[model samples]
Target: MALRPLHPSTTPLFVAIFFLSFGALLFQFVQTRMFSAMLDYHLTFLVVSGALLGVAGGGTAAAVMDVRARRPSSAQLSIAGAVATIVALAIETRIDPVSSGMFVAAGVAYVLGVIPVLCVSWVIVRALREAPEKSGLLYASDLAGAATGGVLGYLSIGTLGGQGLYGVVAGTALLGAAALLVPRPSRVPLRVGLLVVAIATTAVLSIWGETLAPPRPGPFKSDTMGVPHEFARWDPLARIDVARIGDLGDPGHYAFLIGQGYAGPRPPALMMTLDMGAFTPIVMHATDADLAVFDASVLAAPYAVAPRDSVLIVGPGGGIDVLNALRQGVKSVTAVEVNRTEVALMRGPYSEYSGGLYLDPRVHIFEDEARSFVRRSPELYDVLAITVVDSFAALTAGAYALTENYLYTEEAMLDYLGHLTPDGVIAITRWYRDPPAEIARTVGIADGALRRLGNDHPERSIAVLKHGLLGLVLTRNGPFTSLDMQRLRTFADQRGFSIALDPLAPGGQLVDLASAEAPPTDDKPFFFDSVAVSDILAGRAQLPYGYAVLLTTLVLSLTMATVFVLIPVYRGARRAAGNALPPGTVVALALGIGFIAAELVLLQRLTLYLGQPALALSIGLAALLGGAAAGSAVSPRVPLGLRSSAVASAVVLLLVLGGVPLVTSATLAAPLEARVVIAALAALIVGIPLGTIFPRLVAIVGQPALVSWVWAVNGTASVVGATVGTIIALVGGFTLLGLVAVVCYAVAAMFAPQPRT
Candidate 1:
């Protein structure tokens, strides 16, 4: 079987498929963002898993259909998909996830969301089946379209709100339908109608959808904070909302308190929230006397320990930490915040309300990830303050159990220590839970960091204080002097705080570091995952929301794949007597698992290096998919067989796994543009070889009946791989996940089918 060139007459089909692919992927991306705003951050991955399941279902359905009978036109299916997308978006906004419960709401959302994807996939699968000779060109177009969609979707969400972006995706699908009409002059009325509908719908949604069905925070968040926001903005990072809590002139209404113990006259303030949960106050019109309230809190211990001249604040939300530092008479305060939207609000709109806090000449602000900024900075600080950082809902509900948090790792502690003056201290604050898991972990991390820095008795260099539900840990490079200890005791006693850990004082070590859990590292940065899987399985500890949701998704996906895809495909193959399952089937499944597992691992690994999760996702997906497109396009010209391609891909994946840490570390200080380019190149190196394997496997299979089955199996494998890969990463770290991916590709190489001569 020789490769065949695509005919000029198929141009309309090719263009239609491209637009359809673009619209589908863009819709998925926007949906993920919407879910992040509407639900919790950890649940966003469900959208990806849902899309994969839908694709597999569609491919299997197409495979089992009678090829000799008339099927729905590509144009008709495109229109249907567009309509489904809009309806799904509309329905999603009205559902309350909190009241319905996470599991029920997620199931409903997952079902509704997959309908549009299934329609789009059906159209693409039919086109491939109808033109098997053009599989290489068609697949290339598909990958290229998806890559373009991912990059553009990221940019679009920033400019257009989430609702506005949904309209664009629907309009893109309509445009794809219209493209198919180019070869059919008989469908003139259909073409005119589609153009009219596309333009009108896009205009209406872009202009008015925000008022009609704007994305809202979930019931869990909105119940406490109220439904309407004074100011709201959405970006790839997170949704930020500003609420005017009380009148700026009403001093009695705003009793500003610092930490838990401050009880003094304070200025009025506004509340700024992230994802409608983690909140900080924006104090309004405060004089020097009004700022004195900060000195009475447990957070003031670090400032009282020594005469601090300069300070660094990580996550200075609403400028609370900045105000505290200023109150302490610190000479310079540097604040690093990750959310650009939040930064804009502080410096642009709320600058007056904040009394020029962000605009102060003494206060310098950088919009960068905390760890990344610290890694690249050249200045040494007298005190590094990280107090009560992280989302309130996420922490309380254990939603960050599987999420990577680079800030609390031992490596992060080392980085913070390196940038501090010789006698400077690193101050950390976390909510003190029963059994004190977080506090214990914090102590363990500090102890590990000190030992790594060649300090033998870490207890001598560490101090901890507890006030109600809040606990603060202070770690110094050198041992705390007697004066420092006396100052800490005085501050704690004055504020009615208890010393949780101390060096010299008798019975000062309240939370023993000797029995603390193992410290988290950059390789396994799950600081919030205090409960082990074994504990949950043994019924000793309840399952966290994050893990519960992931497990539910996996179970549902597997069930759906088995019922809708695997059964039908198996039956159809059996009915076609001679059309037996080929060796390519195993190769297809392995490719699917290996490709997505490697991709998920790479995204996690790159998140810290790239400075944001959304940026890493966009860059990683686009680069890998774009490289795959190029590889698919050139597979016909390459002389390699399926086995050779699989072997080469396996080699590249292992090489990349070894090189990523080195590359990211060496280029930590590089410009954003340079780092983006380097990350893209790394993805491309692995993707090209991977891209060649699937198309070559398809070519070797030769039977059109088997091609759809192969595609279906690959999609199913991907659906499973997404959840399983995440589980592996959560337990064994990204290194183990990457190794498992290498093993998958190697297995595929052994099962690769020989091409017919």
Candidate 2:
């Protein structure tokens, strides 16, 4: 059978779907950046959850419109989009919730940000409802538009900034509304009104974009420090803010920049914050002198026992560690930092004041994540130094809770060992949250890494301190020698540091190292995880904030499912007893829930491979969306029966999931360009199969009137599934969570509805 061209009446609907999807995705990308600017990158899950729920909300609105027999007016939706643009912009700039009392206001801003997404989604659903026969085509257009948004959003952040992005999204949404009004010439007044609104929004944003969207001092700084921000810059990775305090060219001011979290205050200086909304201060100081390196005291341990020939410093903020590496007379220094703005600030503005640490000929700066740099580098280093990379604010916010941090995992630790010379030492500096608990956690991580590397007597490979701060030193070739031990003791004594666990002594003031389990591993990688529900209830562990939000996501999703998917399907069942409604609805819901569960896990997994959440969003989404669009285009032409198509798709998806670990491991050390190619291929493999299921089901069901109902079921399931996937990963790890997806897909395949054509 030849592909049929869409009816004239449906072409506009298709275009509307495309632009609405484009706008929705663009809006979401903007929202994610805004939230991350205010908070941390870890809250990505929250923004995503909101977008999914907004789609469900839109479907519900469509269901209500269908029941009322009212036509969706494009002009109204465009106006709503315009208003939403203004509201979202205002909320992003104005909301400040640093204190506990203001959390309620922050929550409201988050919810309000989702409204524009809901409006755009509503437009798509209405367009789809207008021509259900073109569902596959419209869905394909939507996915394509989404793919464009992913790529464009990534590009725009580099040039447009947040304000420009807002204007672009608003303009795109207005164009969608205008296109819809093209069919109704008589609605001239409404169209004109929409046009006016669009133009006015653009003008207002263009004129006041700086004041409205400029990066400013966050609530934490304004509420506590009372110092004005010197400069503010935005990037996909983070929002960088610099504040000069106390004096000019003073090293004491340097204390404020890099010495935050240390147990003392020094001369006030320039402070740079990566996450403005951080629960704890994340600052970069100008100098290390008199800056009391309290938490980073462990950073000095490895140097005492090892030669300083070559050093690899991960997350080297404020260039203190780089200076330390150079001061030790290292021949070469490889400094890997994730944030580009921070590096630029150090090299450009603060170079002269801070003695041009980054400008040194020996320093080679790589703007890359720690794990990615470690995995990709083949050079052996004399010292592998990781500063206190853990963010307590991020931990409490649960940004890192659900996501995989290969940096702290067993695999990463072992990989770091691989990059070390014969006498190389791996030094890890960590903040002390609680005494025994943190110690046990850190020891567990280190022990796991050693055991995996076939080091039976892991105790000898470890050097520890029992102060309020801690550091661990591990040797790859062999355990620490007597000379190394003596050196460590001497260094600690000179630095006023206390020793905790020493393999030579066998006993110390610290708890036994054996009790420390290995930190998270690649297979069971969750740095901030719950040991058990009982432990949380018993106050042995604090419940991660991610799980708390997961609960909220579940409740909201189920509520929407009840209202939009379940209620309608039940009513349809009552009205048409022999219509195959039950099987079709079940299949639709299953696919929706199953795909989201898998997609969430895949996104998290890819984040480990890609390093940053922003990169993951850009690359992961592009691959998935582009591949799905290809699959959607091919579905109509495939000759296979519905059941065969379902089974084949599910099988392909399962195979892709099974081979991911192998593929990623092989490309782990490849260059960024090569890694991107591998990621795209992987995405295409999973996406082609995952994308085919929905359209195939739509063909089998063949119920035009029930399109919104099916969409509602699928959207609701996605909302629920995403949250469930995160919880599953938190409890059982990504491997088990993946199996759950495999089961759901297989079940959907087995129970698929056979068309009555």
Candidate 3:
């Protein structure tokens, strides 16, 4: 065998690390995603995610820059590394790493990214440059460590508390140190004997991170960036993964993830179903069979009058109310849900044999956002039950989702009375951390509206909610109510509800619907949407001083272009600098941008086309996630940078181009076609570029030192670009931004002159 160079080929090892780091990154992302979805203000997560990535990118770039320059010995780099590590530590100490907002979050992200990127890049470059013979081993080692972090991080949430972020930071830091201290025969170890000092600093910070987590209902705190869903706590015992659920006071607000993994059956506990929680939480608990036969099931339950009685249930997820109605022996149950993903999950799992029940004949699930469904559904019921909304916290999303429309809309009252037979009863429930005075006003208003409904139909609508409130409105239509203190005693005993609902204040009042037109659109009624959800991912979205997160995003996006595409392409172009793109890439980027544009356009159109924006977005997102997952799994096997990747990328582009018209298919699920198209586009975006980049990156990097160093710089550029992209979109909307993305890709493709093999 021939003698090897100082740093051996460790490409495999680096690949392994990339693979491993993905596990951790995936876990972290999943946790953040779930938390974002359940939060009251999801924009908060977006800010935080962007912040963290921004910092990580910057930090990686800085370190990589030092390594690429080959300016110092391992010793000098080590000293700088230690100092950067200390800077990171100092930053952490200066600010609590738990808040989520504009300035502070941006600062922390910037600091974290700059320091680490610099440090890690330095260490890896040093390792390869010094022990050229062991370059392969060097890559393998980095990959191993990253992989460990990735897998363990996600699977460890139940056990880890607020220490996960610290764990990542600490581990990354320690690895940098190890890389520095390795045999540097090529250069002397810098005489910066901060080893003991660094170790001491680490020990102190570890202790602080362990003890500094705030108390329950904490105004601010940290949690493990672990699991398929991040678990945050007001108290450790009351852990919930919701978006922006608190502003300190325990009674202010709340939101939580209700379902288990995949499409598993939701827990049907008494608290979950009729209590305050996600529809999945409530429906999964109450529903047993699929929707088709639910009418007969709920009516046959011990509490109903007759098997054929009518039943109405609002808010669809698992369609358990439909099942309950079927159990009750009702002839039919009209089920409605605001989110469409749940509907797709039900049908797919049942029909595709993915592990859910399918329909035979009895249940019909209507895919409509609850508000529009109420306005349009012509069906009426004997027992009207609403198991939606958690209005306990008005400052949170409850203000919008559980507004006057659900309570006092002219159409809602009429629909309730229209469906029920004589003496039909309507029941509803919600959790109240603090039943604001507005809630009492709501009760009175709903009564007044019911009286108006009774002025005509008069079957009466009774609303019952917990936290000590019961509303019994008597419409002149009939004697539907059956109670007082005596009935309360029996109902509470039988239903296992605490003695929290006592109907006394204004038993029957008149409502003024004309005056209560819509939920106030002022600051108070603002609910979380996609734009808002992005800012709250991991802890707070703060950054260290002197650094701007938006600046960082722009920096990283550009850096990514430079490191992975632009610079490398420029260098390649220098070899053939004036050469034009092969034309394939131009087509690819153009179509790619088109695909992204279509996703947003279709989402906007859903409200007008199908009367449901949330549902379309949900289905689209779910499918996109699925596509990305598949792409990630398939990429490596194809071998990075191969002509195969280029071909695959071309095919993906072609598919996106072809699929645009079919997005509005005339099938039973014309709505679903958009989702599938979105999924295909997402996979193409992630896979084509990724597969193409890595192979070329391996070639452009040339040596281990270059590989480590170049990655960081690119990362930094990407952060900057991303911020710029977000800003542009905010100013001009998705159409303009999408065009920009396409342009960027086109410019890159035109300039990147790859030589034929």
Compared with the true structure, model 1 gives a TM-score of 0.95
How do the residues 439-482 of candidate 3 rate in per-residue lDDT, one tens digit apiece? 33333444544665644322233333332332222221253244
Q: After superposition, how far is residue 136 of candidate 3 from its true place, in Å?
A: 12
User: Which of candidates 1 and 2 is the stronger one according to TM-score?
Assistant: 1
In terms of lDDT, which candidate is strongest? 1
Worst 10 residues of 3 by lDDT: 251-260
- By lDDT, the candidates rank as 1, 2, 3
At residue 457, candidate 2 shows an lDDT of 78
Q: How well does model 3 score by local distance difference test?
A: 0.37
Q: Which scores better on TM-score, 1 or 3?
A: 1
TM for candidate 3 is 0.43
Q: Which residue runs does candidate 1 get wrong by more than 4 Å?
A: 1-8, 66-70, 186-189, 219-224, 249-261, 505-516, 575-580
For each candidate in the order shown, give its overall lDDT on alpha carbons. Answer: 0.79, 0.67, 0.37
- Model 3 ranges with Cα > 4 A deviation: 1-6, 9-102, 121-154, 168-212, 215-689, 694-713, 724-743, 754-757
The number of clashing residue pairs in model 1 is: 0
Q: What TM-score against the true fold does each predicted structure earn?
A: 0.95, 0.89, 0.43
Candidate 2 residue 477 Cα shift, in angstroms, is 3.9
lDDT per residue for candidate 2 within 101-177, as digits (tens), equals 23454466557766777777776666565655555676788888887788788776756676767777887787677
